[model samples]
Target: MFIDTHCHLNHERLRDDLQGCLERALAADVRKMIVVGYDGPSSEEALRLSLAHPGILYAAIGIHPHDATTWNDAIAARFRELARMDAVVAIGEIGLDFYRDLSPREQQYRAFEEQLRLAKELDLPVIIHCREAYEETLSVLAAHPLPGVMHCWGGTPEQAQRAASLGLALGFGGTLTFPSAQNVRDSAMCIAPEHLLLETDAPYLAPAPYRGRRNEPAFTRIVAEKLAGLRCLDLDQVASITTQNAYRLFPKLALPP
Candidate 1:
């Protein structure tokens, strides 16, 4: 079975037709997914979506670097409560994003480090998002020493190796399928299958020939197909390995590990 280890099905774009989306995913053999949150409301929604779907979905909660400025005591308290919930699998879709820099750099560091400590205290794995700040992100992670995925990894070969050295899996999604994404393919080829996870980042980076369209969990199959092609492995092998990797990273997934 293929697992979309990252997505945003809880967001408004897909929430309205979530049932249909899931059905399509199931039909496409996309059996499991991780719904991510970038803030408090979305985190709660992710938890709810996971509960409703049971084994078919799990939730990763955190305030994304984009919204790090809003990470106050009240939000932290709420995340602490949410962290303990049954459906919550990880503390993430979190980390640094210098590309957007929506939040002040100092605030991003504060929020990232604070959340890193929270994940350690809660004993939960994390799902990280780093863009244009791979070195800085790795430095922070080196200090905290947490288990997480570098969600949507688009870094260089050296950074990829460093991430693997840190015991972090690199998440690959629709970008892998882009005609201009040979670099992503190269990185995917170098990473061990055990240190790899698949995602759609749904309502976002949809794979071609579905590019520019609204992405959904169903398109994760397309991403998997692309990875299979890159790895020169059969689709079943990619599916089995990546699913195992996802389970290994997020033990809170209520399924066979």
Candidate 2:
């Protein structure tokens, strides 16, 4: 079975047709998913979905770099309470985004540090989101050194090795299938199987043939196919490797089955 380690079923695009998305995911052999949150409401929604679906869906909650400005003591307190829930598997969709600079650099740093501390305190793995801020992201991760996946990895092979050395798994998504994303493919090839993960970042970044259309968890199969080809491994081999990697990084996922 394939596990879409990062997706957003809480987003309106996918939530509106939730049943259809879940069915297609199952049909595609994508048996599980991690519904990621970027902010307060979305994190709550992610938790709700995981609660509703039990073994099939799990949640990773935190403030994204774009929403870092909203971080504060009360929000941290709320995340602490929510993290205690059985369905909230990790603390994430959290990290830096220099590309957009949606939140001030200082605020982003503070939020990232605070959330990393939160994850450590709760003993949960993380799911990081990085864009044009790999150095800063990697630097923080090196300092914090929590177990997690670098969701939708877009770093160099060297950086991929750096993150893996820090005990973080690198998650590959639809970008692995893009013709021009040779660097991403290269990173996928270079990483060890134990440090590899698969994700879709659904309702966005759909893999080829289905590119430009709304993405969903079912398309993780396409991402897996691309990775398997790049690494010269069978599709099922990639699936088993990544699924075990996901379960290893997010121990809560292993609890269900």
Model 2 bad stretches (over 4 Å): none
* TM-scores of the models, in the order given: 0.97, 0.98
- 82-137 per-residue lDDT for model 1 (tens digits): 88877889998789999999999999999999999989999999999999999999
Return the lDDT, model 1, position 166.
90
- Please provide, for model 2 over 1-257, each residue's C-alpha lDDT reduced to its tens digit, 9 standing for 90 to 100: 99999999999999999999999999999999999999999999999999999999999999999999999999899999999888899998899999999999999999999999999999999889899999989999988989988999999999999998998899999999888888899999997789999999999999998889999999999999988989999999999999988888888887763
lDDT of 2: 0.93
Instruction: Name model 1 segments beyond 4 Å from true.
Output: 255-257
